[model samples]
Target: MFKRLILFILLASCFLGHAQTYQVEKGNSKYNAFAFIEAQKIYLKLVEDGYATTEILSKLGDTYYFNDDLKQAQKWYAKLFAHYENQVTPEYFFRYAQSLKAVNKYEESDVYMVKFNTSKGFDARSKMLEEDSNYLQMIDFQSGRFEIANAKEINSSKADFGPAFYASNNQVVYATARESGSVLRERHTWNNQPFLQLYTADADENGVLGNPKPMSNLINTKYHESTPVFTNDGRTMYFTRNNYDNGVYLQDKTGTNKLKIFRSYKNKGKWSKPEQLPFNSDEYSVAHPTLSPDGKKLYFSSDMPGSIGYDLENEFTRSDIWVVDILADGAFGAPRNLKDINTPGRETFPFISKTNTLYFSSSGHQGLGGLDVFTSSISPSGSMGKVVNIGKPINTTYDDFGFIINDDTQTGYFSSNRPGGAGDDDIYTFLQLEDLREECEVHVVGNVTDHKTGDPIKDATLVLFDMNNNKIDQQITGDNATYTFRLDCDQSYILRVVKEDYTSNEEVITTPTSSGLMRTSLEIEINRIPVADCDDIGPLLDIQHIYFDFDKFNIRTDAGYALLKIKAFMELYPQVSIEIRSHTDSRAPDQYNELLSEKRAQSTRDWLISKGIDASRLTAKGFGERRLLNTCANGVACSSDEHQLNRRSEFIVSGFGEFKDCD
Candidate 1:
């Protein structure tokens, strides 16, 4: 629609008419009717009078195109092009090329497209078509004329949008503009009166939805509220809501709209009243909040300040991709802009897959018309990568957005206004074809065995936590006394091992933000405390472990509580530099492990470097696991634990960075 408005304005300014001018009467009531026919009549008359202008010719040509009168559309446009030749704007080339292609004048269409004035489209389009014969598979998807969804009435509701599903509970919560419940609050941003309010429906285990119910007052305020995404545990609700400076509005008598995120807590069978999320960027608008399956990373759509290469005044219309790390304390890191995923065009409505793949809506990408859905994978460490368009059958020349997926089942929901809808913009269910076998995830497998009995603990939950208490990802140890988590290479996660019988254990698992090896393996051990001796000073209690990379001691997320201890150790004992030692399993090359170990040790040292640890006092050593505490060596067929011991990293007290020898 915005594009249509812009095109209308361009037509008005660039097209000039003849003596027999045609004015679309305000109350003509023929805008989409024979409006173009009438315009063509007037334009031909003007041409006969020798009063036709290039602008008039183009507008009349556009009218023909809109009316599906392609032959005439081509005739007028081609005449205009012949007169202007290479002096035409990119708009002219695009419009005329489209018209030419429509009239089966491929050669002429190529000529005009070759005359395109800008490199942006030419470059992107060529790259897209260079390798793939199928336009749908030519590029990866995120949005714009790819990705599709069906729009239909899920209930008797007139309008439904802002939909979210609880993959575990099989329930749905969405914002609807239709009158609902006993509430009649103003909808504001949505065309005013009770524009949007949260509604929930019972989506059974198979994702089939039942009767709709308005969300509680605790979650839906008088103002517009919608787009509720569930935490994996289903204990918290995060969504978008607009706020008016109610206090200020009461005093200043000025009502201005500001949108922000709000969260609600579920407790004892009731929901806590929604409250504003912290660290909001008041400088820019924030809306459409989505969470990662693990609940540690939050993916939201915002027009927050980070958008580069574009501005708000013109693009209020345009939004960029923004994300923040959910810290251990649940506070967010400075929300960062994913410039790589954003375009000069608008980007919005982000949905993150359990695999950490990001699906978003965009009007800027080469789209059909209104908006399209696109996808990109997030690095295990949470860095976003290039997007792929979800091509045809999923996208059309209409608004297709609000994509939500339950990747595990290959099923999801989206919003679309395609034909056969109950009304304007209905929700559609999609079952993505799973025929393409994607790369298998590498797993860190082992057991949370009791340190004393060496027996696997049953019913223990192995939760992965980041520095921010936000759960990065979680996998419960299976009944087999073994737990497995599949993570792509390059993820830094700290796992928390917990059981009711004993103190919790901690282990480190580090993956680079990018995979360095084709495969990696890990084993985590949890030492159990005697259930009777509750006061045991077991080292397994609430330990925080941080790991480093081989031969490079930068903080690589690996197993255990020592890293948290390191952080606390540094906080308690500031001005300290520690010697970090990296060892290996000995079966490998000695020099390789030694240097790798040294580098790995320094990685931890550097993690502390910015934490006020004096660099001069910090020393890194690579033992290559040469002096093993057990009988494991580079060539030994040792037990897994022996192998684990050989790969251990430890630190000793050092002076500080400044006291060390100058490089």
Candidate 2:
């Protein structure tokens, strides 16, 4: 389930050529054979006998680290760093940092991260840490997007992971280390468990798996076999297995059996012999295969020669995701490393959804801890988009990987080695409550038109402001009277349109709270400044109504829009003085209503003054139930709408004597 298992397998080969004492050589042989549990026992015995060298300490730490025993890994790594800090390489510092995070010692982990950054120059993980010091808060913001549950029915008391959908039969195929009843069964010393074998289980629409059964022997081999991906038709399959050919297990000169991908076909309900993929090599690893929606591309994790993020000591210390084109003639094109998606740590178990979104597990990207799941958009031309962590509940301090999903159902499964599972690794089903992408944007588009004739008003200036009245963006309407602005989702904004001869208009709009691209269209209308007598004293702005809450005086977003209109009119007639009159309904006591209305009026006057209107030009007054616009007065029971009519604010022209023009 974790890519480190593969990485350790590769690292074991590098240690084979070194010379050591008899006891250390015996422990190294066990470690080289993917036997971490036995290797741990041997190394511990060596230390117990007073032979604790740096090599023994380093291998002791790595054995536990690769086995997901981070607590034990942290203990030995602490010893390794305490005595041999200057002697060990930078990777030990990085590994110690990762192990420290598993125990929630983030401050201690950060210290080692600083050391790793100082030594491992140009590593993206260090740069990410520098840029997002509060990365934990960012990951927490993306939590609760998924509801997850363990698939209990198909699980056993062993390692079971790498779930893939066989769409044609509504079955799930996965790898498990459960024992099969065979006298000659061979066990992998890696975890002291039986070799992995592929199994199938019937899955319901809700992803509940049952009736588990072993897959055909042709596809399941005596050596490790896992991580199978199927094409749409289900006749063709690609899976990972130990390098075996013609009934013999194959290994390179170092005597380490590497993993390779193999393709098989089904005919008449039987699977043909799997052929090793052309890209597989005797020197490196290729595993965890996934197919694109069109079945024309194959994605897998590899630690091959061309993989990025090679440390000074070893070239295969990390794994990366690679893609190969499925040629029309049923052959594979050369594999291309996903440069944009790779980093200095492991990236593996890639799953491509129907929407061209790539979901994979990574230790290279910023996350809560060990291999966390992340998503990136894959363009039609195979370019990668920004990578985002598919945050927690799906990911934890332990390894989480092998993610797959059906976008339409918003349901999927992923593997995790976190606590409370029936096995070392288990598959969990989840319903995604939100999209994995972190950014959500809404586009506001509208047109300006004449209020009377309903004609397009060109050359109008449109300004956008947030709820706090801070200017965000501005633009001028073109000949078509259209304007647009991009804004964040689930926020309220005010759009003000103005022209030289037309009365300015303001409209309040709120965007939707959903993910992805959204659009809102509007048609705003404004009228030319009206002509009036010099002594005219009445409401000048044609606002429908500006209503406050039941007893509150603070300005609401809608009320702010109306108030901006009044401010604009005052700017037009600089010498005009206006009164901001506020009213209250007859529900409260008369004295209480009068005081509340006074506060409302003062709030409106203060708001206008804040917008640069001269205080001497504006005055505020409160009208209690004494001035009723309708028949809803004291002792009268009326509908809510009738009472709402009285809860209003109006801007009236009190004096215009300074303006001599009377048109």
- Could you estimate the TM-score for every candidate? 0.47, 0.63
Q: How well is each residue in 1-663 modelled by candidate 1, as lDDT tens digits?
A: 999999998887666532133343311223223345555665666666675466667666766655434556778888887786555445556557556654556445544544552423553332222222122323323223323345343533455776897647587787776765585555332222345778887775556666877878667656667778888888888888766333221211122355778777889878887777775544555788888877877777776555752553331335777777788986777778887778655688898877888888875554444467778888877667656567655665556688888767777778765556766557776667642223323445565676655676767788877656678766565434555555667656677877663677676667555522222222334432222211211243343223343334455444434565665655554554555666666665777777777776766667667666656656777777676778775566777655655565665544432333222
lDDT of 1: 0.60
Model 1: how far residue 422 lies from native, Å: 1.4
How far residue 309's Cα lies from its native spot in candidate 2, in Å, is 3.1
Quote the positional error of residue 324 for candidate 2 in Å.
0.9
Instruction: List the candidate 2 regions with Cα displacement exceeding 4 Å.
Output: 1-21, 182-184, 440-663
Clashing pairs in 2: none
lDDT of 2: 0.83
lDDT, residue 283, model 2: 78
86: Cα error in model 2, Å: 2.0
User: Candidate 2 vs. truth: CA RMSD?
Assistant: 21.8
